[model samples]
Target: MFGIKFFLLVTLPFVLRFILAFSTFAPVAAWPVWSGIKPRNSRLATVAEFFNLKDRKMAVDASVWVRAMHGDKSAFKILSERCESDVRLTEKIYWKLLPFVSRLERYGA
Candidate 1:
């Protein structure tokens, strides 16, 4: 889920554009998306089925990502509080930066 946004909004644009341009024999639209210019958007629920987090690191990161990305500070705070007693691995700053996270939220995208 975390990498999905970066891969879509950041990586895909550059990488796909390069490949499409280089492979002059083929067109970008041949890919699954309307065009290789962007990622194939899907519901969060559907996507969730695929992002199988393996351990505590993945869980914490994904938890922070899903919560922070939505500006759900209440949930993040609750999670953070729980972390103080047990994990202590996640930092406070990771819960901030709503503005940065907002960029990744493409509703209906």
Candidate 2:
């Protein structure tokens, strides 16, 4: 009985903690929450880096949103490249950026 109690107290917690320490699957939503938070030396940054999206995507997307809204061509290109080149980036981002496409076309840029 003592051995069973010792194992449960000492070993089980460690095993469970290790197994659920972090997630490998990329998150599809809640960009704002994860963008600013997360401790230093975190796995979340690693996931972001692997996807090649700067600042875990959300922060940079905000910047892209501002520039694209103003009809910046380069920002538009960056927005398209983000959606097309990175499978991790969802089509929703592309749709959000589409509002500026007509302005760009009007300017003939």
Candidate 3:
């Protein structure tokens, strides 16, 4: 029938191409050729490793008051000073967020 002939014409090339593609890729899929390959380290990772120790020290120093808030007034004073400077500098550096901060303050955060 004409319908059967048309169906075969449309499907025969697609089935052949699909089978050929799978056959071509079978060897590539079966072999573990890239198992020995190692990825190169990024420059960012090296820089981060260099500063990681210093970052930890700075974090500990900055949080000294938060960790001992009730026990030490000096620690609290230092924390307040650092927080004021930190907020001012951050706002200056990220001018785009100035509006967002204003909105947050309006909301009483």
Q: Each prediction's Cα lDDT score?
A: 0.44, 0.46, 0.39
lDDT by residue (79-105, candidate 3, tens digit) is: 777667556544442342222232222
Tens digit of lDDT per residue, candidate 2, span 25-100?
3322322322223323435345455334443443356888799999999999888876554544443333332332
Q: After superposition, how far is residue 14 of candidate 3 from its true place, in Å?
A: 44
Candidate 1, poorest ten consecutive residues by summed lDDT: 91-100
Model 2 RMSD in Å is 15.1
Query: Against the correct fold, how does model 2 do in TM-score?
Result: 0.28
* TM-scores for the candidates: 0.24, 0.28, 0.29
Question: How many clashes show up in model 3?
Answer: 0
Clashing pairs in 2: none
> Highest lDDT, which number?
2
What are the runs in model 1 whose C-alpha is more than 4 Å off? Answer: 25-109
Candidates 2 and 3: which is better by TM-score? 3
